[model samples]
Target chain A: MSNTISALPGATYEGAVRVQEMGLCGMISLRGDHGDEKLISAIKDIMGTVMPGQREIVHQDERAAAWMSPDELLLLLPYADVRDALTRLETALAGTHFLAVNVSDARAVFRLHGGSAREVIAKLCPVDMSPGAFGPGQIRRTRMAQIPAAFWMPDEDSVHVVCFRSVAQYAFDLLKQSAHPQAGVGLYA
Target chain B: MMILTCPCCGVTGEETEFHQGGEAHLTRFGPGSSETEFHDYLFSKENPKGVHLERWRHAYGCGKWFIAARNTVTLEVYGTYAAQTTEPPQDIKDTLSAKVPGWSWREFA
Candidate 1:
């Protein structure tokens, strides 16, 4: 958690549920035609790396993930990177028309990293979150509030992620409620 | 419910997979579109209550984007295309060979 707690104003928080404010500055959706080999190379050149390709992600100076289908990739980096990245990317492929959308405000991130985080996330999310099934390095963008959210297994008990900001608060509430009756062993103490 | 055909995985799934693109005629925006016209464009939208071409994503299931011919009137869906693409240089030929993220557009097409 290199980033700090920068509060997002509009969304409400329970405060009752243990919440950690994860400020994900921005999300970039870089889309090129599937067979656009030239564009693919340009993306690799600008990012200094290629997209993981498929349901995988690689973290570098900027976090890149092969989300959904092959033609699209999701990139996450500080808000500062937007200008340079977009400019270099667009200039690199001037004539080639590609889709690069800035979705920082549209998405948010939250980590259920406490001792009971796994138990809580598993009960709420339909996807299998077992330590063995979803370990570090694996990424899945699935539904949480019926809204598309990205989830990744960063560690044994740490499920790091980014989701749509509109439903971020509700998604956090539902996850906390999944462990309502059973409080965290070391959460408060 | 709106049925969105996945361009990647050919099959009709719940409209849940797609993110609703407001109107179909969005591309028709051109020059001399006056301020009033822009107002009408932004505010007064043509929400066809019948069958129309809409953009939706295979959000939860396939993670693909396709065009869904949705009978907004009857709420029945007829078909979906991975790249009813709205982009020139259309057709799967150019983009088919390269691996599409999680799924292949060629395998199904």
Candidate 2:
């Protein structure tokens, strides 16, 4: 049996900011009534945190939950724990009108690190990257150059980006070019 | 370069972040309806120079469809509301009514 691999395992690019592909992180696309008690408790049990607010992301250690929309969420955890987490969610909310599907392989994650992290992302995305406008705990699903992508900051200088696996290479290249040393726009400085 | 605010997620962004879904609040003429009704439903659209209510999807953001009230000529946006609504909200209507005197679109005034 062939071992499962990520779209760009261990891929790294060092420009003004560092871009590294984070391999094989588990992601579950959960859709349901966010106000439902069963769904809330089920997610709390699996993610160890409360459901996030609009465009918010909550994390405890490696487990995290991101509010994707009014009725949807994205759960992030260890790749090996996906099956178990899905089973737990299914069993916990057996009769509820909810959906929990493993989307780990369908997506790719990247970590952007360095002082110019926000500038690199600002060049590609149309979001307000100013410190007061965008900071940690906020997740934005926006167009990254020519593709759809989501990103959140872990701290002041590090950003975590997510995009479809099919566009992993393209997204990486876009980030690489945006992070070129001479390409800094100094908007966020 | 239209700027829109999505009521679903409260994200204000450029038009590139959204996709226009055409006219809003249309009465569907589904199966068993008369041929003319179906044709009008499919082909007919309101092309107003001012104070137009249309459907817009926040395609790159929250992926929710919402209604946008804007002027076609001046590009002035009155407001945006939920797509599930059957009519423009009272405040949006009032805003449009004040800006464009005696403005009425189809059955709305």
Candidate 3:
């Protein structure tokens, strides 16, 4: 059997902020009516977290559920547990109008660490990156430079970003360039 | 830089985050309709200089379609609402009425 590999596996860059590729994250794209009792309970049972509100992300340990849209969610868990989770979701949602598919390999995740982490992201995205505006638990699906990406802060000093696997290199380079040690804009500082 | 708010997720963002879908509240004139009606439905569009209603997609955000009542000339946005609506809501109409008196478009006034 072939071992799974992450896009830009083991890549790391240290600039104003530290950027590292988060390898092999299991992600499930679940689409359905958010108001449906069956859908909500199934997600709660599988992810051990309640459905997140709009633009919100709920995380417990390695499990998380992020609201992608009114009828869509992005569930994160251990890569190896994706198969079992999908099966459980399917069985729980049988005959229900929903879509639960493993998207672990289709996307890439990067972690940015350091006090200037928000500034690095702010340079690329149009979102308000100030501490008062964008803090922990808030997830934003927006354009990073030119690619479709989503990011959320785990705390004041760390951010987790997800983008398409095809653009992993571009995303990494963008982060690295924006985080250049001497390029600090001091806007978020 | 035009700013827009996605009614689906309530995220206010720049125009780059949303995709303009041209005219809004378009009524389809499908088969059995006259050629003129079909042509108007497909090709003809209201290019009003003021108080224009349009469709916008939150392409980089929630990926939901919404409606916007904007002024092309003044770049004033009256309001945004869910795309499931058939026409601009009453509050939007009231706002537009207060701003541009005697303004009417298509079947709305």
Per-prediction DockQ comes to 0.20, 0.89, 0.90
Q: Show model 2 residue runs off by greater than 4 Å.
A: none
Listed for each candidate, the true contacts retained, as a fraction, are 0.36, 0.82, 0.86
Greater lDDT among 1 and 2 belongs to: 2
lDDT of 3 by residue, A1-110 (tens): 89889999899999999999999999999999999999889988999998899999999889999999999999999999999999999999999899999999999999
Residue A133 accuracy (lDDT) in model 3: 91
CA-lDDT, candidates in order: 0.59, 0.94, 0.94
Write the number of the candidate with greater DockQ, choosing between 1 and 3. 3
The digit string of per-residue lDDT tens for model 2 on B63-93 reads 9999999989988888999998999999998
- What TM-score against the true fold does each predicted structure earn? 0.57, 0.98, 0.98
Q: Is candidate 1 or candidate 2 better by TM-score?
A: 2
lDDT of 3 by residue, B3-95 (tens): 888899999999899899999999999999999999999999999988899999999998999999999998888889988988889999999
